[model samples]
Target: MNIRKRYLTLILIVAIALGAVGTYVGLSVFAEDTSLNNSGFANSDPDLIAELADQQENIEENMGKMSKVVDAFSIIQENYVEEVEDTQLIEGAIQGMLGSLEDPYSVYMDQETMKQFNEQIESSFEGIGAEVSMKEGNVTIVAPIKDSPAEEAGLKPNDQILSVDGESVEGLDLYEAVNKIRGEKGSTVVLEVNRPGVEDPLEVEITRDSIPLETVYADTKEKNGKLIGVIELTSFSENTANDFEKELSQLEEQGIEGLVIDVRGNPGGLLPEVEQILKNFIPKDTPYIQIEDPSGKKTRYFSKIEKAKGYPIVTLINEGSASASEILSAALNEALDYEIVGETSFGKGTVQQTVSMGDGSTIKITRFKWLTPDGNSIHEVGVKPTIEQKMPDYYYTNPVQVEEPLTLDQSDSKIENVQIMLEGLGYEPGRTDGYFNEATKSAVEAFQQDQETEVTGKVDEKTAELLQTAIIEKVQEGEDDLQLEKAVETLTK
Candidate 1:
């Protein structure tokens, strides 16, 4: 009788607290009596019974809406023709929930994916060793790790992994594709690669191995009687800061005049690692990156440094450079006198935090949007270089220039093709005729000038190929990259 009174007193206290805020209070009535259902709550304390009834009504309301889903699940389990596992159903439901957000970065990872995720952060994993992302709904290779099987197999930037080991990856998620690609050491995985400008898919067979993450590749070169330090950072991983510091020490000891920090195909990693690296270049207590939460609460991360390196810096970025790379590049460009060369960065300014469920599963969710030190948001609108430079074809193996130049008044089938292409590109090449006239020469000269080529009236092989490649790909074309040359010139000056 004393125990019952104490339980009723505790229930009354909880009910009073909940009623103060007009919230329903729940009470387990039949926890001690297995035979008594929730319907038997009428026999309990009156005021406590009222609070319990309110909670029961709320539960029924929620469950009423879920009845359709329960019914469908039951029907699938019992009446469906093929057998379906409960695990698959639960995982599919979770995947659907995340997919409803329409975010490529937000995803649910299973046990295998969770394992690989941890392995990547630890800086060692058995796989082809490439960073991939879901771009335009396809598993696209951002870049291959240096000295890894993927790099050794000649996997270039922007290669699409279409299939793995004869299994199609048409609708596979990024993590799912990664699982398919990763295998035990010494095993081989055949990947069907779709490379730009290639007619058919190329079959690339790569032998997987334990790939150690070595993010920074450093070297020095003598140009214009000054030693220039060239540091190629692949990603900002766990040991990147230490590796970079060692390389920087080596270069500084040699008295390098300038530094060229290349992050051309870097897909980015660990924000804190990047912050640690940035502190070496930027001053102490300077605002490096700002992050905004969902409620618009902003937090600024500052550099923790004693002294700054006083060398002229140049950061090289391309379409593959993303996330941490963007932050570092933007900070250097905004806070220092460094020049950002190459194409615009791969803008992924939103930050994601992974939460583990303690059951070998995890969910990666977007939690914040990061801003540059200048308070500029670089999410979809990537960081544009001060000097705009386009990357040339990385896989151009043929001879660049043709044997003979196509001149004015020359009647050839190729002339007609060029005229058609020029007209299509809004160059006003007069007509798609076999004869190249003065109008054709003027159009060719205009095209060459726009392409940053010599303004020659005749269509040389370089000019012709550039025009054709640009027309087909709708991008810049050049055998010699003027951007790197410009960077070397800037360093010398």
Candidate 2:
């Protein structure tokens, strides 16, 4: 893989599940000819020169407004209650300027922040290596980088970070929460995580290391005597093309009859990397991706290679899949006639240009809009899969309410159900009695530890759900595996 590909990895890396609305942050390198050091501004364009002149005239006209701001700053510096650092004032001014745009995507990164931002796009970093976002007003894990410390620590997608090292992160900003998790190499950070399906906060201790961003995963599964190859792409990283080629060769040697390419939580990476990946499956003349500039001029990107051997291919995607992931599925569906399964994607159609300043600061601004090969704009409207099937709901249907934390020595009829469920799950919650006793507390603690929830020995909403779901799964084993069954059937058929 080329070093230039590493620079492109910064694209489409910002992905967070907002409350009802999810925002996918994507990196966009507008033109192949555009260099990272260059701003890609066409200085030779007469129209752009005219626009620049007009902008300068406007700045002269707005000189009075700038004077007022400068006057206010002088007044503050001269007569302020406390001495303020010049750097603080300057960075704060920059933040205020960008914040006034009302665009959450536009942010001002300081030296340290910019360093971390650039490191995030690199092949490796010293951290837990999990992509996080502010979802539902909480810090949530978008996806753990493959083979990274986060994945090794069992950090999963949609897992909410309740606290970091005993400090609650309820209202912490996304970047601040990320900073808290990042630390020196070999250092340890304990996180309190609240998972979606599980009812209870889990305590996860992770030792920070040099996290490697390995993207491709391949496996072979035999279903109904048919050999099926599964390639799971976590993200499009710098070495994704190389990793993919090796995986594809291995799968080919395995004599697989069909292939399933899963990009469920792929937050997307470099556009060129995805284009190269598509080349393996698409023909040379096929339109892989389309880019539309601000003036409505359209440009089509094509694959350089012909389609590989005829093999039934099925691609899996979900709402977590954004930008380049959507591009891959759209290209495969458009060119090779492959079927896409799973839910709708994270519809992020806009491309972002990462501008690096001379002072080591950076600003990522939205630049252009992207489209599928057939000229379908995916901005805010994600790619709809051919087979739109939501993952089966395994959450607890039975509501278990607890106004207060139930502890030992408290008498409540609710304790009986907890005891019965624990015993059924083989936790030995002691004697199915209505009274909450020490034996039951011990059982609850044991159950909570096993389920990786906070060992409060009390039934909270999370704990109760875990208990109910456990019992339900125990009662209904070998059932409700619809999505897996569908994938197997599709591959075997």
Candidate 3:
């Protein structure tokens, strides 16, 4: 009786608190939950609020709807075609919900899923351990977990995971794909890989094993007569925080000079991981990012740990540099004055939070927009490199160029730049060279015609200036490029 009474009291308290918060925010209890249907305010009086709730209103309607779903599930479970475990049904329902969200990062984890997730963060997981990532709407492998089953089976980065055990991975997200790949130790997980520069989708069977994930790869080398440490961070996994610290200590031991932090294809894993990494560069008490809720309540992520003691650092970014990569780069560039080099970063500043919906389903929503230390938005506005360094010549092997009539090729820097511009404006360009190449000239002619210029098969200084202006306009359009987006918490107490 005591326990039952306590549970009811707790429920009543929770209900009261939720109602109070909803009222405070002026969320209309009388209106539909849809953004377009909201009335912006709620009616006063507890009785009125209770009456509105009792009328199967808003959230109550949702609860009632959910109750119907569970009741249906219960009925189905009692009279199904075959005997089914409740847990399996629940897991399937959860997976379906996550799939509906279309968010690869968000997942509803059962005990097994939670165990696997924890292993992925801890830098160890069973089965064919491949670092699953999304590229061009396909769940791809960034790289096989180093020395894991996938790596041993020759799974490389940029390998598209087409199918797992004959099941197409087309609609499966990273989590679902991961769940499919993971199995009992010594079990075989067949992955159909669509590798670039390969004619066929190669099938590779890997025996399950505990794969170790090394997030931070650091090496010391003498480049240009300067002792430089190149650190390649694959992802911001939980283990990366410790790995980064170890590397920092090693750099200190080696008498740190110049550091090249490589975050080329790192899809951000954990927010806290990036926060900890930033602590090495960001000053104590320094702002990192601001998370804003739906009701416009803002919370700041500050640099809590003392800044990591270091030297001249240069962060190398590329199109693949995203989430945590962008976060770290923005923090270093804006707060530490560290040089940012290489290509523009992937602009992903929205923070996502996942909630379990009691009915075995989950909800993952964009919860906040992040700002850098200087309170700059870092979403569409990617951190611009301090020094623009084109990809090295050696890295270009048969690099395609834009086909322009009466022009050289993509090797020409101007044509290459023009191609980059076209790519930015949702056009395809073969190469990014500065030559008056065939591809370049054709692209340039079209671009000029669009701008009411004479259709000349050439890229003159005027066209170049126009391209620059277009790039600038894109940056200024609230794309969140504050170097990094950390908030100042304006007037919030």
Candidate 4:
């Protein structure tokens, strides 16, 4: 698409996407603009006027095709056992239309839900601070925001939420599940999560709080006598691009010889933000990303930067890196030949835009599929790293659920997790094969002693909590960040 056409398309989408109040304010301002003609519309944009006209015609034709639907609504209103609200019927019809698309990403949100969504766009909300999506009829976590309650509670990407508190979320939509997950700050919500590779479900209690909107974090690591700048993106929020540029400039001023762009646990946000960040590194010779519309028409977007960075750069990603994160990783790897070091990312290649129904309600529809720089769509298949690296075994271990003290000879998965945690904490448990033998007891006793707890020589509730806490602290210390080390090595070598 040409620049003007693309601008018009974006305007149309935004005009439709804004909430009812926003739309009214926007149109009121537009109508009062001095540039408007006698008809109270901008005559300067003839092309936009034509596009609007065409859209009106399409809407009219589609409305004509919906006569049968109207008839059905009338029949249901008149012949049903009980009277149905017109608002309910109307909302149902809208939902039915979106549901027919059979896409989990396309969903209908009522007025209340739309308000919460707008709050999210404005940044800051009371929730667990995690991105989630519908996958295989389950509400699965995309990734927890950095330092958020979800992350603190150890929620991982692809962790399927089975229940909220004690209620099952089996038939609820993504927004509904999210509503259940969100609450007033300081309120605790128990999530029953089914993590991959874990035989049993885990009950994680998370206290809701105001989720922070800070997206970019910058630091430096010295390897091989070279200072390697590390910029980790937690998400691509509204100010992420500006923050990234400032951080990058500071890093460059520090005379860093290498850089590692980490998007390990980033469940993506605003595409334009990632695009702006990519412009700093991706040369002008290639397109940074491509958007393919439903009609199979693709629009390639390129950065204006004429040259790549002088220093070597590497991208760090993992299963939690998704959407815009995948875009950045794929573009850097495919366009600039940068090494991607980590596990495959969370595949989310579609682009969604919300459209208001003009009544505070909204429908978020998947309008396009985003392709990588090489015209490859990583939809269900995530962006694979050039150098695949998995974290330590304890990083993937599940939380130990202690019903009773896990004594010697216990062969539960919880015991196995404890063993892994014990091993990761440097107290070798002899084996991680789920069997709690004599050596495992010794390992438990050692850990309890180190923790200055009662040395029971058996895994108990207090012992399990201590073990999980130690593992979290170790992971947070970044000492065992194998993927980051590999990334630094790649950049330095």
Candidate 1 residue 152 Cα shift, in angstroms, is 3.2
lDDT for model 3, on a 0 to 1 scale? Answer: 0.62
Global lDDT of each model?
Answer: 0.75, 0.71, 0.62, 0.85
How close is each model in CA RMSD to the real structure?
A: 13.7, 10.3, 15.9, 6.2
Where does candidate 4 stray beyond 4 Å? 1-44
TM-score of 3: 0.57
Candidate 4 lDDT, 309-421, residue by residue in tens: 89988999999999999999999888989899999998999998765667767778898999998899999999999998999999987788887999998798888889899
**TM-score between candidate 1 and the true structure:** 0.68
Off by over 4 Å in 1: 1-75, 197-199, 306-308, 390-485
CA lDDT of 50 in candidate 1? Answer: 75
Cα misplacement distance, residue 374 of candidate 1 (Å): 1.9
Show the lowest summed lDDT stretch of 10 residues, model 1. Answer: 20-29
Higher-TM-score candidate of 1 and 3? 1
- Greater lDDT among 1 and 2 belongs to 1
* Model 4 / residue 353 / CA error / Å: 1.4
- Compute the lDDT of residue 282 as modeled in candidate 1: 81
Index of the highest-lDDT prediction:
4
